[model samples]
Target: MNKIFAKQFNKRALAFGWGMVMAMIIFMSTAWFAFTTTNQKISAEITSLSILEDYYKEQDRLIAYSETSSKLALSQSFYQLAKDSAIDITNSCKVINNVMVWNNNCHPNADFVKQKFLEYYDTNFNSFMLEYPNKMDITYTNVLENTTLISRASPVTFSSEKQGTFAKYNFTYNFEPSIKINLTEQGISLEDFESIYNKILECNKKIECFQKINLENWDISTESQGSWFLFKLKTKKPFIFYENDIENYAPIELNFIIEL
Candidate 1:
């Protein structure tokens, strides 16, 4: 009886040991599978986040390039327009008596020139809008009397002094064949200027021409440079995303002086 009892107890103990070993193996397999799945999910999320970061970086780079390119294009176009207008105005002058003259005056008609400039600018602006669809505005100002006239006269040296000798060169003063009528008041209309200019041109061939022009309100002077006009161009336009304040998101503008 003692021997049978020992054998049974040994068999029971052996069976219980095997059951515990199988349970441990199952638990270890489940834990390892859960850890691997969690690790893979976390790695996938990290990769997705990295891709998003790269996409945003690329977008920022493209936006910066676009803004820089747009500003350069607008600046070039605006300057070219102003330059063309000035050149056209200068071309209207004719050389008379070694000086440039416009309609018997030292400069072109300011009002007329401004009108033509506006017309040409407006026409070209229609085409410019096709490339850059922005509400652009331009302000132009001109000083007609500030124009420089081109002359054909060479520099003349009249006198020179040395250590022991003083020499005087005989130079003939070739007066300009044209006369300029200066009015002090700025209230004169363009018509008044045209009429006065015609009268002055007509008087150049007559003796005692001062009496003919009725110089009670006008002054007389010789024709010279600084009687023409120069203009300024100012252009402004809004940004693509102007609703919010961003760096360099202010209104774009270009300003320049246009000289003929």
Candidate 2:
């Protein structure tokens, strides 16, 4: 009896030991799976945030580029229009007084030249604006009289030939005639500037791109390169987005007679 009882107790103890070992194996497997799943989740979240960061940076870059490009296009149009008006005034003067005169202006010429230019400014600018509504969007505003400058050629006297030979020939000449016209004013209409600005800002996601185009925001100057007009249009953007700000500028050089 004593031997049978000891064998039975030993069998029960072995079964209990096997059961504990199986339970331990299951617990370890479950713990490892939970750890791996948690790690994967963390990695996925990191990747998603990185992608978002890159997207925002690209958006900001695109916003700046669009603004710069649009302003440049508009500035070139303005330069061409103004330059053409000035050139037309210059083209009207070919003085018939004394062919030997280098700069002749005795035909009552330059006064009418300004008047003709005013007419061209009104007609051509209106036509151009009407044709390219989305490109430049500028209207024919009144020219600033105070800013308009006209430099007319003074009337020249006949330079007669003193060489008293060869049947005493008489001739006339005009050499390299020129006139200077300088016009200074805010060319873009303030009322119409908002629509133009909004068009430029359409590429931005959330960065505040609305800027008021006041005189204080502009620094414009025109330099003459021979007969061409070089316009430098500048503006400062006073918005800050976490230490990223780009200065916008457009430099346009246009020869009056050329299509550029």
Candidate 3:
């Protein structure tokens, strides 16, 4: 009986040791799996943050480019309006003592030009801004005898895809645009000066020219000598008004200086 009891105790001890070894192996495996999962989660979070940063950088660049382009567009629009107003005001002028006088019975002055410019802008250009949904502030200033127009466009925003859902990442741009319009006129070569001169002489020299001569395209000045007069005619230079092309246009001064 004593021998049997000792053998049973030895078997019980061996089985307990094996069970402990198995438990240790399971615990080690569980710990290793948990560590690996935690590492993967950390790596994924880091990669996502990196991607988000890159996306924001790209958005910043895009917004900057857009702002530049918007300024250019606004400047171009202002230039067009100024050119149109100048041409219209200049075209409607009459020549008195070799000087051009506008329809408002005034010579070339900044205040008058500014008044007409504002009138033209209010009448014509407001339609263009209606296409954009954002509010824009446009104002005119004359500081130190300089004609300028300022345009302020509201901030424009762009959102990212799924990545921006939680972080709320977005890009926005605001543009401050202003243009100086000098009330200056450039001289251009007259293509039909000879024809115009001939026509003026033909009309003036005619006897009983009771009919009003069609000098619609020209502004006229006269020098009188004892009931006989010589006609001095000038042509209104045409402006090629285009929105995108600012430089391509006819000059505004001394298109024709012909006397008959």
lDDT of each: 0.38, 0.37, 0.44
For model 3, residues 62-120, the per-residue Cα lDDT tens digits are 44543443333333333443333233345655554443332334223444445554554
**Cα lDDT of model 2 by residue, 109-227, tens digit:** 33443454445445543443344323422222334244343222223222233232223433333221122223333343222223322332352422122122234444444343343
| Location of the lowest summed lDDT over 10 successive residues in candidate 3 | 183-192
Top model number, lDDT:
3
Clashes of each: 1, 4, 0
Off by over 4 Å in 2: 84-187, 190-260
C-alpha lDDT of residue 146 in model 2 = 44
Q: Is candidate 1 or candidate 3 better by lDDT?
A: 3
Model 1 TM-score, all chains together: 0.34
Worst 10 residues of 1 by lDDT: 174-183
Q: Candidate 1: deviation at residue 238, Å?
A: 18
Give stretches of model 1 more than 4 Å off. Answer: 1-9, 86-260
- Pairs of residues clashing in candidate 3: none
**Model 3: how far residue 154 lies from native, Å:** 12
**Once superposed on the true structure, which residue ranges of model 3 sit more than 4 Å away at CA?**
86-260
